[model samples]
Every structure is written in structure tokens, then in C-alpha cells.
Target: MPDMRVVLARELGYCSGIRRAIDAAETALRSEGTVAATDTLLHNAGEMNRLGSIGLRSVELLSDEELGAATVLLPAHGSTLSEHLGRIASARAVWDLTCPIVNRAHDAVSRFADAGVPIVVVGDKEHRETRYLMEAAGSQLLRVVTSEQDLDTLEISVSRVGVVYQTTQSREFRQLVLAWFRRRGIEVAEEMTLCPEVLRRQDGAVALARRCTAMLVLGDSSSANTRRLVAVAVSACPRTYLIGDAAVLPEVGLNCVDIVGVVSGTSCPQTTIDEVVAGLRQVCPDVRVEVDAWPESVL
Candidate 1:
């Protein structure tokens, strides 16, 4: 008889902001006949597909044709609110679903740009959230970096640097970047704009990894927070795998590990977590699963 134990992270699955965005999108789609988003409204493909089946359209960028034909839903990840709204200009019904925390991040970066301070963003340069932050900063002196190596390539001439990161970046990574800039004698304004829930998820991932023999992170490939969860888990538990769903569990050699921790990205659906746990049960029928509640203390 194989002895298998699975533990669920306390802070796994969808955060309030994502829930609100989805709820709002669903409500709007029902009333508006057709709704379009500036980008994928949520990173979870399952949730996106659900909305798609009901006629929720995703547009890479809004053009006159899109603005005129349907209600445009701005994503929870920050978008150029004023700019986008202005472009529409009373031509269409618009729902501003930008998360309040993300809006705050945008405002913080705008303030730094207004003060003429050189800006450095710690996140994936091509990420939608990072792109929003860059757009909010306008033409200010800006550099975006993910690691210490990326920082070395910056050609910044300013002595004073303003720092802000994507809402999904882990706090530990943010501190490391801040320390690196300070060591170089740069005056770094540390305006950490990370989502509290997302940061908590990373904390939870670290704790989950420390206790489990292996870890499974649930999230879509395009989810930033999901990728962060994977990174955090791998740092502590070398046997960490990022899977979009539970179907990959078998191929990833899960049966070899006696204990596994299950953590998910903020945007990941609760149903996916349930499905993964169910799949685990099916794989190891006699396995005992426990809910790891260590993350509750941090909350």
C-alpha cells in the first residue's frame, strides 16, 4: 500500500479582486448582450472560457469597430483608464474593472514620473500589468528588470531612482532589488505596490514547500502570480511542478512522492483546486490528504 499525503495551502485560489471582476463581467454580459475586454479579464483560462461561452469577447486593443459594437470591460490588471475612456468618448458603454490596488500602483508610478525621478520596475517587462505601469509612467526615464542580471544592463544616469513592482511580485524579490540599488549608492524610493493577497500566497507557497516532499502549483501559463508561486515553491522544494490542471499530475511523477503540497495562484479558481485534489485521490485511492493551515496565521 503506497502511503501518500497531500496538503492544501491555506491561501490558495481566487482573491476578492478577481472574483469581483468575474462577477461584474458576467453581470454586464447578461445585460449588455455582448461584452469585450481590453485584455484577458482574468488569467485563468477556465474562467475566461466560461465567459467566452457566454459571449464575452477579448480584444487585444480597442478600435473604433470594437468600441461601437460592444460594451468594453477593462481588465482588473491596470489599464490606461483615462486614455482608454477618452478614446471611447461616449461612443460605448464601458465597465472599469481595474482592481483598486492596481489603480493605486498606477497612481504611485505616475507620481514618481511627475516628480521627474528615474523609475525602475521589478517585473516581467512584457506582462500586461507591467505594460500598464510603463504606460502610466509615460516618457519618464524607466527600466524594467526581473533579476539582478537584468539590472546590470540599465543605462540609468539618474542618482535618484523610484521603484515599483508588478502587484504579483513576491515581497522577498522586491527587497532584494531595493537592496541591490541601495548598495550602488542610488537613492531608491521604495514604493512597493504588490497585492497583499498575492504576497500572502507567495508566503504560503514557501511554507507549503518547506513541509512537503513535492509541490504542485495550480494556475494558467499566462498567470504572473501562478509563475511566482512556482518560483517560490521551487526555491524551497526542488520537486515543484507548475501545472495548468490536475491531468499533468501522473506524468510529473507524483506517485514517487509520499507528501505533496498544493498551492495555487490568486486568479486560479477554487473549482480547479477541488479538481486537483479529486485527481490526487483517484491516483492514490488510499492517500490521506490534509489541509495545511499555516497560511491562516499570516492572514
Candidate 2:
């Protein structure tokens, strides 16, 4: 087998918002007797398991039975005011961990709706963040499109529109939608709503993919950012694979390739990244791993 080289994406692992959410969850677990999260607080099952050991529980919805906890924590993805108003009204102590970027998205959607501009939300329809954005639109003329193809189904006969996307969506997808609208002679308000850190990670994935024969992204399947990373990597390298953690490394057959790229989403913990790197070293002992320098602040 040829000597192997592993190129690490520059922007991998947790971003500032995810770091804050994790810290807040850990803090809640320490002080509260029981804490229930609106959703799996940030998508990393290992981290959730660790928090669960300390009395953190995640509920799909905030019904009466789920609201008996001492504290209810909101996921960093944020939720719609209309959809979550009842829960917010009933919670005894609520720790809203919604990221500021997502809050801005809600504001942007509200503003566009208020202006009577047709709003298009570009993201996965099932994603929590996208669902919240849709709910925020209220009775406004709104459409949700995961790709450019979805736009064709929209009966938008208007000349002007506004665009907002799930915080973790790629800029490439957003631009594709914008370009499509512009081609049809429609004026786009263009609220460039994607998260900067998420875009940075996607760019990092593309850069690494260009030089590697294979790429492995570490993150949970449920995470929007994780799915974006896989999509970005697959565009540049067909051998890209998305794994939840280091344990899946050998099974993914990284040993069969000579050059590999490694990346993770903002929801991924640094410990997971370390384990993935170690797993790569162990499985391919002769390989040279060149990890890019990342800021220590996120760790």
C-alpha cells in the first residue's frame, strides 16, 4: 500500500455558539436537579449521553409530562415564537440557549414578511431551524425549498422576494436559489442569512477535498451542519463519508485510501475530534497526519 497522508480541515469541531450551548447545558446539569431540553441539545450523542448521566434529558416536544423538570433548556437552533409560546409560558425556569445567528434569522424572516415580500427559506424542511423559520413567517407568503428544483413548484408570480436560509446551510445553495430567482427577473432581497462559521467549515471541507483521495466527516446525521459538511465534501471528493465518531473509522475503510481529509461540524466536541485523529493513526500506522492549526478558544 502507498504511504498515506491525512489533511485536516482548518475549521472543524465546535464553533462559538455550540461551545456556549455546551457550556450552558453543563452548567444547568450542575445546578438543577433535573433539566429537560426541547430537543437533543446540539446533536452530539456522546455529549448528550455525558450530560444525561448528570440528569439532562431531551424531549421531542414540551408537553405537560415533559415540563415537570426544574429547568427547560432550548436548543441552540432556536424555535418559533408561535410554536414554542405555550412551552415558554409554562416553563418554571427556561434557559434559552438559542444562538444569536438563529435569532437574527427569525428577525430577518419577520422583517421580510412584514414588508409584504414573498419569503423563501432555503433548507431541509424537517430541520428544527428551518421549521422554526417557517413558523416565524406566520401568514405571510412563504415557501420552503431544499434545492433549486423546489422553486419550480412555487407559484410565485411576484417580481420581488426575500431570501433566508437555515443557519447551517451552505452559501452555495443559497446562491443557487438567488441566481435562479434573478434569472427569472425576480428581485431578491438577499438576506445572506447563513452562519459565518458554518460557511467557513464548508469552505474548509472543499479545500481539503481538493487534495485528498477520501474524506471522513465526524458528526451526527441529525445535525444540519454535519449534513452540510458531507454535501460539501462529496461535491469535491466522491469518497467522502460521514461518521458519528472515531469508532467508525476502521469500518469506513480509510485504510484502503492513500490520502484522506478529516472534518467535523460545529456541534462536534473536541474530544471526538481527538479520538478520530487517534483512530486514524491507529488504523493506518504508516500514515502521516497533518492537522491544520485551529484556534484553541473553541476547545
Candidate 3:
């Protein structure tokens, strides 16, 4: 086996929004003994399981009885159901944990819709954030563009369109959508809604991946930001793997690589990143590990 070195990205793990949500969940769990969310609070499974063990519950939709009796926590990703705002008003208690950034995106879309501008949302149509944006735009929402194919099939009757992004989308994708609008001589009122912490992690992952022989992206498979990190890393280093936990490290053939890079999604826990580092050390006993220093402010 080759001598190995592991480099950990500086901006790995939980963003402020996710931290705020998790903290709120724990607080609610302690005070009320049970708290419910309309959906999984965040994209990470491990964190959800940890919270679940302590009385955090997720429901597809809260019933009137559940709403009347339980403390309901709005998800960090925000919600599409505007009617829920009315229902939540009558709940026992409500915690609106929507990220400030997401709220800003919502405000931007609402302003565009109020101004009678046709809106184009550039993100996964099925994503909760995208759905929220669409709901904010209402009938002014033209369509959602997830790929170049979506843009190719797009038929815009208007000369000017307002653009909004899912908070976790990549800058590259944003640029692609903007460039498409530019080429067509369409005026764009672009709202910069991408989460800064997510972009920082992506930047860190790509930088490390460019120099390493293999890259490991740590986060739940269902996490959109985590999947984006994997995609960006794979573009820089072909031997990139997305693992939910440390147990998958041995199967990833890190022993063959001289240099390995590790990065995690914003929703990932710090403990998971530590476990991955420990797992790397176990795989290559003489491995040298280096971790970058994180910034003081991420917002």
C-alpha cells in the first residue's frame, strides 16, 4: 500500500441554517417532549435519526388535532403550503426555522410576482425549495429549468423574466441559466439565492479534489447539496465517492491512493467527518491527516 495523506476541506458540515433548525428541534424536544415537522427538517438521515430518538416526529401533513396539541416546527428548507401558515397560527406553538437566506429568496420571488414579472426558477422542480419559490411566484411562475434540455424546450412569450434559484444550487448552473437568457436577448431580473455556506463547501471540495488522487464526499445520499458536492468533486477527480458514513470508507479503495480529499455537505454533522478521518487512519495506519481552518463567519 502507498503512503497516504488525507486533506479535509475547511468548509465541511452543518451550515448556520441547519444548526439553527437542529438547535430549535432539540429545544422543542426538551420542553414539549415531542415536536413535529411537516417534512424531514433537513436532508441528513443521521441527524434526523438522532433527533427522532429524542421525540422528533415528521408527518406528511399535520392533522387539525396534531396541530392543535403539538409544537410544530417548520422545516429549515421552508414550505410550499401557504395555507399551513393559517393552520400553524392556531397550533399549540410554532417554530418557524426557515433559513434567513431561504426567507430572502421567498421575499425576492414575491416581489417579482407582485411586479407582474414572469418568473423562471432554475433548480430541481421536485425540490422543496423550488416548490416554495414557485408557490411564492404563484401564476407568474413560467417554468422550472433543471437542465439545458429544459431551456431548449422553453418557450417564453415575454421579453423580460425574473430568475430565482433553489438555495442549494451550484453557481455554475446559475451561470448557465443566466447565459441562456442573455443569448436569447431576454432581460433577466436575477435574484442571487444560492446559500453561501454550500458554495464554500463546493469550492473547498473542488480545490481539494483537483490535487488529490481520490475524493470522498460525506453526507446523506438524499441531500441535494451533498450530491452537488459529489458531482463537482467528480468533475475534478474521477475517483470521487459519496458515503453516508465511515463504514463505507474501506470499500472505496482509498489505500491505493497517495492523496485523499474529504468534504461534507452543509447538513452533515461534524462527528461524521471526524469518523471518516478516523476510518482513513485505520485503512492506512501511517496516513498523515491535514484539516483546513474554517472561517469565523459563514453567512
Candidate 4:
């Protein structure tokens, strides 16, 4: 018998933020009877497809056709909240699925701006969460990249910089950016509010990958956390695959690997993980499967 060992990452799966967002969307879909949103509730294609089969659909932004009726769900990735306020004013109902973790970040910046601190949101400019935070904070926001190029070009002299981050970005990235601003001797009141769910899941992915030669990172392609997990696995182990489901598995191999690991993002469901694991086991019956400790530490 080929000695096969499968390392199952304990932390590989949906984060609490995605769970809460999906639950809120489902509940809103049931209660409101019809719903639409600015974009997909989560980055996962599988979950969006599942939602499509039910009733949660997205509409073109602020069109007259989608106006006057129906509930709209703002994705957990917070966008400019004020942009929503006016549009939602016309809707019969609004189901705010903004993750509490994100909402806490929003509050931090909003309160800081209200207190007259000049705010600098450190993250990708195009991300939905950054956009939302800017809108919520109104006039007190400017986006900052890793270097000072963007900040140097700015015409304003900010007395105090209030920093906020995207909930799903790497915690290491968040810390680096925060430290960069403070190093300049500028007054900074920074809120380190990146979602714990992200760091927890990321650490879990790293831990799980340690025991396996190969890993399958289960998650949507666009999911920040899922991508991070796949990256972590590749770094820890030699070979890693990022797949939405078992169908995404490469046809050429899997039975060849003596040790394989499976992990997923916070947005992924248990069924998807089980299905992939089952398929891998079917291909290699002798493979030993064990839980990776990352998720256990998180819980």
C-alpha cells in the first residue's frame, strides 16, 4: 500500500464575517420577497450562484428601473455608506449586510473625522470597503499607497492622520502601512481594525500546510482570504492548488501525491470542502487524513 497522508487544515473554511453576511442576505431574501444589491454579497462564485438560484440578485447601479421598490443588500465589504443612503431612501426596505467587523472600522474613521482628525485610509483605492469608508467619513478622507508618492502630491497638510484598513487585507500589510505613516513623525491616531477572521484563517492555512506536501485551497478566486490561504500553502508546502470545488481539480494528478492537504477560505462552506476531500480519497484510498491545528486555535 502506498503510504498516503492527508493533512486537513482545521482553519480552512468560511470566516465568521462571510457567514454573517450570507445569513443576513438569506434572511432578507426570505423576509423582503425580492432583493438586489450593488454587487455580489461575497467574492465566492459558488455562493453567488447559489444565491442566484434562490432570489438574491444584483442590479445595475442606481438605474430608474430598479428604483422605487425592492430591498437592496449592501455587501459585507462596506462601500461609501452615503452613496447608499440616498438610493435606499427610495427602496421599500434595506437589508444592511455590512459585516460588523467592517462596521467597526467605519465607526473608527467616522468618529475620527468628526473629531477633526484628517483621515488616510490605507489600502487599494478601488476596493469596495475603502470606497464605502470614504463616503461614510465624508470630506475627511484620502487614500494612501505603500509609498509617500500619493501623500506627497496631496495639497493638504493633515494635522492628524486617522488610518483604517480593508477587513480582508493581510494583517502584515496593515501593520507595515500603519508604521510607515508614524515613522514620518506625523501625528497619527490609527485604528488597527482589520478583521480578526482574516488573520485567524490565514494563520490556520499556514499551520495546516505545514504537515502536507500538497494543499487544495477551497474558495472563490476573487476572495482575498482564499487567495491568501493558497499563497500561504504554497510558501509552507511545495505544491498548492486554489480551487472553487473538486471539479476544479486538475485531471492529471492527485493520486500521485502521498500527502495532500485541504483548506478553505472564510467564505467557503463545509459541503465544498467535504466533496473535494471525498474525491481526493476516492483517487487515493490509502491516504491518511488528519486535521490541521489552525482552525482549532481560532475557535
Candidate 5:
């Protein structure tokens, strides 16, 4: 077997928002003996398992009985459910770990709703973040567009509409939605709510994927940002693979590849990235792994 070279994407591992939520969960668990979240803290299963091992309890919805005098941590994607918020208020302590970026999107939706303008959300309809925005928009939510087909099916009753997007939505998709609105002569009140860290990771993945023989995207499949990374990488490098961790490296058939690129989702932990690199080395004994420098903001 020939020696292989592995290059890592510049922006890999947990983004600022996920890191903050995890830190808050840990801090609450240490001080309060137990911490509970209304939903999974993040999309990564491995991180969720790690937190669960340390007194982090996840519930689909907060109940007054279960939350009695317990500390509650909100998910990073934010929630607009009044019932959930009301239940959380009764807790002994509440840590709102909603990412600042997500909060901004919520605010944008509220503003549009207040103005009686129909809101068009550009994102996955089933994603928690998109659901939050849709609920925030209430009766004012005009449509949720996940694809060009959705836009084609859209029937806008108003000449002007407000647009907000899921924080983890792809930039290209947002652009497509915006352009669709423009083609129909609809005035758009747009809020660019995509996460900066996610954008950086997507850009880095595309760059690395173009040059590598195969690409590996590391993160849970359920994560929207992680799945977007895989989609973007595949468009540039068709041989892209989405793996939860290094355990699946053997199944990926990387032995014949001379160059491989690695990129991770925002919720992924650095330890997972390290494990993938180590696994690559084991697969190709003479593999040379190179990691890009981390941005100071992430450091």
C-alpha cells in the first residue's frame, strides 16, 4: 500500500454556541448535582452520552413534577414553546443556553410577526431550530422552504415577506431562496442568521475536498450543519463519507486512497477529530496527517 496524506479542515469540532451550551451543562451539573434539558443539548450522540454520564438528564419536554426544584438547561437552538418555558420557570434554576445567533433569528421572526408580515423560513422543516422559528412566527409564518420544489409550490398572497433562516442552514440554499423571491418581484425583509463558525467549516471543507481523493465528514448524521458539510463536500468531491467516528474507518475503504480530507460538524468534539486522525494513521501506517490552524476565536 502507498503512503497516504490526510488534511484536516480548518474549522473542525464544536462551534462557539455548542461549546457554551456544553460548558453551562457541565457547570450546572457540578454545582447542582444534576442538570436537565428540555431536549438533547446538541445533535451529537457521543457528546450527549458523555454529558449523560455526568448527571445530565434529557427530557423531551419539561414537566412540573420532574423539574421540581431541579436545574434546567435549554438547548442551544432555543425554544419558543410557551408551555415549556412556563414549566422551566418553576425550576429551581434555569440556564438559557440558547445560542446568541439563534436568539437573533428568533428576534427577527418576532419583529416580522409584529408587523403582520408573512414570514418565509429557509431551512429544514423538521429541524428544532426551524420549528422554533416557525412557532415564533405563529400565524404569520407563510412557508418553510427546504428545496427549490418548495419555492415552486409557494403561493405568496403578499407583495412583501420577511425571511429568516435556521442558523445552520447552508449559504447556497439561502441564496437560492432569496433569488427565487426576487424573480417573483416580492420584496424581502431578510435576516442573515447563518452561524459564522458553520460558514467557515463549509468553506474549509469545500477547499479541502476539491484537492483530496476522498473526504470524511465527522459528526452525527442527525446534525443539520454536519449533514450540510457532507452535501457541500460531495458536490465538490463525490467520494465524501459521513462518519460518526473513527470506528467506521475500516468500512470506508480508505486503504486505496492517496489523499483524504477531514471535516467535522459544529457539535462534534475535538476528541472525535483526534480519534479519526489516529484511526487514519492506523489504516495507513505511513500516513502523514496535517491539521489546519484553528481560528483565534475558536481557540
Candidate 6:
């Protein structure tokens, strides 16, 4: 019998921004006495659990008081200016791990809003990223929605519109949004704010799954990028499953399959992927584990 050939997408795992965020968090945890993160380090549960093992804790950006010798780390997702102002008033020092791309999108909100463009952000309203964008735009009201109907439901009276997306949103979603405006006879002036990491990861996942009989994704269920990876692979490869860890790998007639592709999301730690690979190797000892030859990066 041929052992399964296992593969991984080129652009799987943590991106550069997440790497920086985790690094800053670990540094804060190791610092003497006490340090505070304006909020959770990242959205990944695995990463958050790892941080919890250390001395760090998640503090609301709204939580402010006198801090004697503590370092306050602004969220990598970037808090609103108002939140930063509140934190700046008392923290000894601040470390900002905000991703450069995310920063640009934030800056655009105000720039476009001031130019009389109605701002419509495509992301979850409750998310910290979207919240910060709303704050930066300084609008008494803003609209946040996910689907086409959500866009049509908006009562925005402006003729011109400024559009931006959640950091990890799919390009297809954005395209659909763009097309919607065209059909409605409204023009959108969008910022160049697509998430490079998500685009890269989606491309990689699609490419890698094209050849594999089955695909497996490792990530937290709540992670948008993680779920997006799964969706990307599944669209190309019919057999795809998103697993939180290695122990969840389905062994249903594994002896019948010739190959499987494995991948992880930006929020996933490399260590978790290694563990999954190791576990699967134990299950299918002869499985050929490989990575793409094209290219893969931290994104």
C-alpha cells in the first residue's frame, strides 16, 4: 500500500504582525514586577493560553488607573486614539505592536470621512479592530456588516463611499462588495487595505489542496483567518476539515487514501503544526510530509 503523502501550504502559520505581537507580549511578561496589555495579545486561543502560562494578563484599554513601574502594551490590532489617550495618561511606558497594514486602514477612515465619503467597514461590529476603526473615523454613527444584504440595509445617504475591510477578509467578499456598488450606481473609493497575509494564505491553501486527496487545517474555531483557510482549501479540494489540533485527525479508512494536505492559519503557532505533523506521521508512518516548492512566508 502507498503511504499517504501529506503536504502543507506555503503561507501557513503566523504572519509577521502576529509574530511581532507575540514577541512584544512575551517581553512584557518577562519584564520585572508588572506589565499590562491594553487588550489580549492576539485572537488565537492557543497563543492566548500560552501567554496565560506566563505572567501577562488582558486588561481592557478602558481600564485605567495609576500604574507604578509597569509597561502597557498597545494591542497589535491597534486601539482607538481615545483608548490610547486613556492608557497614555497613566502607564509608565507603552509598546505598540500594531501591524503596519492595519494602521494604514485606520488612518484612511478619517481621511475618507473628512472628504465627505460615507464610510462602510466590512467586518464584525463587536471586533476590536472594527471598533477602533469606528473610533478613528470619529463618526457618531457608522455601519458595519458582512454580506450583500447588510450593505443594502444601510441607510447611508452619502453619494460617494469609502470602503475598507477587516484585516483578514477574503478578496472575493471585497469584490462582491465592489460589484454591489457598481450595480447600485454608487462609486466606491476604497483604500489599499487588503490583508496581505490573508491573501497569501488563501492562495497557498488553494494551490496546495489542488493535488491532495484530503486537506486538514489547524486553527481555533473563532479565528476568521483560520476558517478562511478551511474555506479556501475546501472550495478547491472536496475533502477538507478544520481541526484545532492533531488529536482530532480523522482516521476513517486512512489506509485507502494516497495523500492529504495539512495547513495552519496565521494565528496558529508553528509548534502546533509540528505536533500535528508528528502525530499524523505516527499514525501513517510512511506518509510523505512535504511543503510547497513555490514560496511561503511569514506574511
Q: What TM-score, over all chains together, does every model reach?
A: 0.91, 0.90, 0.93, 0.84, 0.93, 0.89
lDDT of every predicted structure (CA atoms): 0.82, 0.80, 0.85, 0.73, 0.86, 0.76
Residue 276, candidate 5: alpha-carbon lDDT: 92
| Model 1 ranges off by over 4 Å | 59-69, 81-91, 295-299
**Cα miss at 61, model 4 (Å)?**
9.8
TM-score of 5: 0.93
Ordered list by lDDT, greatest first: 5, 3, 1, 2, 6, 4
- Model 2 regions more than 4 Å off: 1-3, 59-69, 293-299
Task: Tell me model 1's lDDT, rounded to 2 decimals.
Answer: 0.82
lDDT tens digits by residue: candidate 3, 65-145: 776788988889887676475666677877888999999999999999999999998888888888888899999999999
Q: What does candidate 1's lDDT look like per residue over 1-299, in tens digits?
A: 77689988777777888989989988988884557886788898888998889988765455677667778788888676564756655436878888888888888999999988778878888887888898877877478888768867766667888898888888878878877777788888878798888878788888889988888999998898898889888999999999788788788787834698888887888888988888888778777878887844243
Question: lDDT tens string, model 2, 1-299?
Answer: 65578878777778988889989988888884667887777888888888888888765444675575458888888765753676555666888888899989989998988887788888889888888788777777468898766876766877888888888888788778878887899888878788888888887788778878888888888787898889888989999998888888778776635688898988888888889878887887677778755432220
Per-residue alpha-carbon lDDT of candidate 4 for residues 55-96, written as tens digits (9 for 90 to 100): 776656546556557788778887564646666667767677
Worst 10 residues of 4 by lDDT: 290-299
- Model 2 Cα shift for residue 217 (angstroms): 0.7
Model 4 regions lying over 4 Å from their true place: 61-69, 146-160, 294-299
Q: Which stretches of candidate 5 lie over 4 Å from their true place?
A: 59-66, 292-299
Scored by lDDT, model 2 comes in at 0.80
lDDT of 3: 0.85
The digit string of per-residue lDDT tens for model 5 on 184-210 reads 999999988888778888878887888
Off by over 4 Å in 6: 60-66, 140-142, 250-256, 294-299
